[model samples]
Target: MPEALAILQKYWQHDTFRSLQKEIIDSVLSGHDTFALMPTGGGKSICFQVPALMNEGICLVVSPLVALMKDQVANLQNRGIKGIALTGGIKQDEIIDLLDNCQYGNYKFLYVSPERLQSDWILDRIKNLSINLITIDEAHCVSQWGHDFRPAYLKISELKKHFPKIPFLALTATATPRVKEDIITELGMHNPVQFEKSFARKNIAYMVFEVEDKLFKIEQILKKNPQPSIIYVRNRKSCLEISSQLQTLGFKATFYHGGLTSREKDKNMQLWMEEKAQVIVATNAFGMGIDKPNVKTVIHIQLPENIENYYQEAGRSGRNGEKAFAVLLTSPSDSIQAESQFINVLPDKAFLMSMYNKLCNYLQIAYGEGINEEFTFNLNHFCHKYGFPTLKTYNAIQFLDGQGIITFLKEFSEKITLQFLIPSKEVIRYTSLNPNDEEIILTILRTYPGIYEIQAAFNLPLIAKKSHHSEAEILAVLHKLNEKGIIDYHSKNNDAVLIFNEIREDERTINKVSKHLIRQNELKKEQLQSVLNYVAEKNTCKSKMILNYFGEKATTNCGICSYCITQAKPKKDFSTLSNKIMALLQNEDLSSREIQNKTKNTADDVIFVLQQLLEDNFLIIQNNNKYTLKT
Candidate 1:
């Protein structure tokens, strides 16, 4: 073990293991099923990585996020470790070659998405490989009790049967006690070690602002703290608009959402990380794998779906163990809009079925006929063709996705649409001179007939099948032509790529939509509303409200919250210091330190009385800072 630690340090440059990382790794090394619940930044990867190196056979890691796995694999390779990942984007031959490498080469780790577990070839390959350990990242997806539940995860539990004796390590960041049990039962782990970490962060000061003018409140937050911050919005267009608005306000800001191209998203993120952009106006897509430790604030413009997401996102701040603020800017109008959006989200089964059927018709396929078919389902194009509200209809489709009807990550897949930019005679002349590639030239001509006069890029896979070459080989040939100025190809690979915005399902069939699923979504909206309510019903300690949401039994008021600081302390004798202060600023928000300076009292004494007044519901904080007597 000491030798193992020394090697880990020498290779990875980490001095020691984080909390429970050693225990989890040791359990797996001893061939025990391990269920690890490490908080974000608790170092979950090392738990599997160390044992994987010590194990006799390849460690197969089943994951959900393909881009994250790829990033990790790239980092591993940088550290001289051989790791491979299998996702939908990779060609079948490429995946086969990777599996072969695991079996024959010195590869010790293989990361694959849970969706790939559905493939017959993948299961067969796993049965053949000397796979000794299986690690499930984000294992909460397998449990219906979890917040981010996915039906594809159900397929992963079956892997236990394929390699009966292989040690299984299930890991997640945020799971309730119920979710924890569901993970254990779903994975059939016996007496697994439960390494639960506290969700509490003393360094983060949770503040909920009750504001009619959220923009004004945002301006105040920036003016007061003005450090590197993340502004989380709900939609893609909002990301752009908000970032633009912030830029207009003289703050260096950039937007990041799931909808952007991989290059654009990565560029924006790197800019933010490098401080080229001091503030990131992002949707929920900004924080994963973010190592910036000094993010001073995380401001939510609307609301998150649940506390788990809120906590994780907010936790991105104060990672450097410095004081940070997690603020929520909520309004009654925002709440109404959020609720309205939720209510309008349920898709009628018949409508969904009709849409799916239309999609199949457009793609020229029968029911269940296009099993592995992939297409660019442009919402604007589809909505234009069908005459439906693009946003609302698309959200309904997303709801269907949430119902386990389909796999939808809400991102785009960049694919090749090969169209020739020249005449057939010209192409033939070029191919004649380039006879070494006559096969691809002839293949393209045979597959995409009249490509020289085409408008749309021909489907590479469709062309590949017609050409009798693998997708990669076909792509390579196309790339050469593109490089030689004969054709053009586009690659749209992105981490936050949408798998299936809505799976091609029989939408017309009336099925029991999981109330559990809807409830999960509803919880997210409710979480947002809670922040709204906290801000609106001010004079309460904002940090205290946030802590309670994470199931903290403590009710001790966070006196430092905007609400507590603004509202004057209530009079104990019906004529105390709070009463006098309230009389002075009856309809205003008072800065606590400023008020303290005026009152000539200690911070604690002022906070205590203000908190008492807030508890007594004597006043409410509003807008940016001050408080008003409750009517």
Candidate 2:
């Protein structure tokens, strides 16, 4: 066996590489600048990881997300491979120690965020390491045309000067042709070997439905599938509400969103992964490093912000090669809502400049000063003080962060402490009276060994998992316990930390990236338009549409998509069908099903003709909820 194959088997325990994996690995191993455009679940990691292992020194991986870096590092550690992640919040001394370890401790992988590359000291340290390969994950971020463009990703090209001979491997799950060209050019790849696997999931049946009641449609889909599924919503509120609605309707469901505590997110994710929950309703934040091969359906309850996001989220299903569904549920109002949610909120160059000036003032940073200064930022307080709209202000700040003018660290700490005020006997009596809260209280008592003696910090989500409850339920019980003097519970949420990367040259800073800002807004508009078109276009195959968007010219339509399924049915003479329905309705009122039975036409065709008749004022629905001829 090849050395790369041996390494893959030893580490990943896979007997063979997925399509394009081996070839990409070979290209990288042969010291070529390689670009691998594999779709999600295509094992893009292995293309770099396996070959990196076969080399003599460590691999340096530059990624866009700190969470992704941490996940990859954890996975490497789990396989007995030494890896280190230089994520945010690490002090310079700790970074020195970690770099030292990477230099001498036989570390095989060093994962760092693209922002970390901007530090000269860190780059100097990295220069001394025995790096064999340079891998850029989410490489599309380097391109302004990409959906998730980050200016910090451009700094990755500077590493080429340091390791001029090392092979550079760029990997991304989704990138348009424009973004693809930008990635290669920005990375300064020399005669790069590009491998693009078709962005088509043959096993997934893309489905779209326009419905009056989304929840009812969701229920019907879940009932018919009865398998592990994901329902994607746009916000945390929807995540909670939809998941709760599903649970009330007798489905095992859980909710996840960015607002969730890390422990809560873990517990909820565990429930879904373990199959204890049949459905997980979440926002776009849920599926970064998750790979569950058995997700039978991915239903989007709202229009996604763009096609790239929707493609990645929807592609999460059908990974096990069985037939799965990617369903989008929309309403007449969703298009307007989507426009308001995505387009209207886009911060233009003017808004970005104004917000940047305001941010400088809010932070009290003087001109040409406050570089490298970090402050605790309360977004709501800042927005209220300036009388700026919250969402747009947030987007402006995010744009600033993306442009590398600032570093916004949104992950803050939540401190929760607990101590039992009542004696053990009293607690037992209280639990006996409130049996519903018994499991939670008992789990807390068992998990925190010193809760009775002193105030202890407990994992809220762990208790919820052990008690088979949710974090909200656990918090409610804790608050109740505190109210009754059974326990002393205190929870404190901290504000986010913002680090100013550049000095306060407010207008100049915005001006330097003005073109990028304008281009980014345009790109967002185009992407959102693509999504709207995808949802609105009913004549084309959904799979072919997605494939075409990703720059692949699909020659054949996928027969399993909603459009293909509808088109495959024999075309009905709708006028003839309508006449028959009208004649039947002339005699007596009949329900749609009864009409189908009498006419011997498919329910869908019958419903279509009935709708046409009703729209033309040739029919009406009586109080008995049956079709009837107008008197």
Candidate 2: stretches off by over 4 Å: 416-491, 573-607, 610-631
Q: What are the per-model numbers of colliding residue pairs?
A: 14, 0
Tell me which residue pairs clash in candidate 2.
none
* Model 1 spans > 4 angstroms off: 1-4, 348-351, 396-552, 555-560, 563-631
Estimate the TM-score of every prediction. 0.74, 0.85
lDDT score for candidate 2 against the true structure: 0.89
Tens digit per residue, CA lDDT, model 1, 1-631:
3455875787788788766787777778778888988767677888888777775678899887766797889888999999888865466788888888988998888898777777788889988888878999999888876766767787777887888888889999888777888999988886786676666676787876544456656776888887788999988888988889888998889989877866688889988989988889888877767878889999998866666787788888888889888887765467677666554554555555566566567656665555544544566666788876666667555654544344445456565566677777888898788776677678777766766666455666566677677777877777898897788666654322223323344543224554544565565555556545555665566666655554555556655556665555563453467866676566455765556777787554666566668788986766655656788
lDDT of 2 by residue, 302-386 (tens): 9998888898999999899999999999866899999898889888888888888888888889999977788878888998998
